[model samples]
Target: MELFFKYLQYEKRYSPHTLTSYHTDLGQFSQYLEQVYQITEPAEADHTIIRSWILTLVQNNIKPRSINRKIACLRSYYRFLLSQQQISVNPMVRIKAPKAPKKLPAFVPEESFNTLLDSFEFEKSFEGQRDRLILEFLYGTGIRLAELIGIEENDIDMRAKTVRVLGKGNKERVVPINDSLLSCIEEYLQYKKSEFSDNNSEKLLVTNKARPLYPKFVYRVVKKYISLITTSDHNSPHVLRHSFATHLLNKGADLNAIKDLLGHSSLAATQVYTHNSIEQLKSVFEKAHPKA
Candidate 1:
């Protein structure tokens, strides 16, 4: 298990969050094996025993998606064992993933996003301008909160209107910036530089006391600004990302283009935005049709 985790971190380049999840999932599976089957080694496991374990998970009312993830973990574990001559056959060969429900991601309305941005008065005040720029960049770029917080000053190119982002798996991609956001970022950088010059902080966004921005701080900033303009309870960086993708899809952007812009690993991941577009189309159809 330790070797597998090392493989995930070093060879596969999985993010810390993904590595952590794999650890929890695999740890649970190992504990179940020890407690139920009295099997401490991977070689002692077989297809029937694995099947019973999955049945137990189902009986416990675990979500199908979560069960599927556990199955994947087990499959990977067995494959590793096979390579090491611990097991000859992979038990998960014929196993099928349970059907998962098609649930759409929640996104804030465009009006609400606009209101959120407008509610911010970006005066020369250090905190005000910093908060406003953070909101602007997140909505404009659709970058993940981690990527945004991890951004260095040199990652942005105002001249080229592009941001060089290091996304999941440490893969780098250049996302374009619009004119308005370009202007905002430029002004914000100037203010940030002047404000933090005495303290020598390299991060793009910081607290009023010249500290690096943390995840909780970013969430609070988003919540505070969004609460002023939106009545929705879900106001976070992820909601902004959803809105960015949904709005692009609504504007007739190509699905592949949206995938590249959002830095998704697969087209299936990007397809979730299609559901939002379909909902919008349904609304337009119901409102415009004369035959009721």
Candidate 2:
């Protein structure tokens, strides 16, 4: 398992969060095998044993999506073992993953989003400036939470009006920044420098005390600001990302261009935004059709 993890880290260049999930899923499966069948080596387990585990998970009311993820983890591990010649047959080769429902990504309405950004008056304090920038950065750039957290001072190219993001799989992509977002970033940086003189942090967004931002803090930041303007039940950094993509598509932006901006590995992932676009078209048609 350790060797396989090292391979994923060094060769596959998987993100730290993805590595953690793989470790947790494999760990849980190992524990289940040891406790239930007294088997310590995953290679010793056959398809029947794996099927039983899946049945157990189903009986325990595990969500289909989560079960599918676990199955994926096992599939990857088994494939690694096969490549290494540790196992002659892959147990997961014939196993079928359970079907999971597809949920449409949630986004804030354009009117409410614009009103919040334009009408609200944030305080002059460094915290206020930083908070407003955090929300705007996510909504404007459509970056993932981890990507935003990983941003450094050098990532922003002020003269070029672009921010370089290190995305999943250690891939780097440059995203364009509008004047409004760039101004906010500049203001936040100035606030950081003037208020926290002794601090030497390079991370773009930080706490009031100049500490680096974390996931929980970012989540709270999104929830608080989004709640103020929109009644959407789902509010998070990803919601802002969805809003970015959906809004762009609504305005006739090309699907492939949005995919590149969003740093998606494939167009399939980007195509989901089209659902929102189609819904918008339906709404317009219903309101404008003369026969109605």
Model 1 segments more than 4 A misplaced: 122-124, 198-201, 207-212, 231-233
In model 1, the clashing pairs are none
Q: Put down candidate 1 lDDT per residue, 147-203, tens digits, no spaces.
A: 898887788887889999989999999999998788887788787778777877777
- Model 2, 115-172: lDDT tens per residue? 9999889888798899889989999999999999999999999999999999999999
- Model 2 CA lDDT for position 228: 94
Q: What are the runs in model 2 whose C-alpha is more than 4 Å off?
A: none
| Per-model TM against the reference | 0.87, 0.96
Task: Score each candidate by Cα lDDT.
Answer: 0.84, 0.92
The window of 10 residues in a row where model 1 has the poorest summed lDDT is: 116-125
What is the Å distance of residue 145 in model 1 from its true position?
A: 2.6
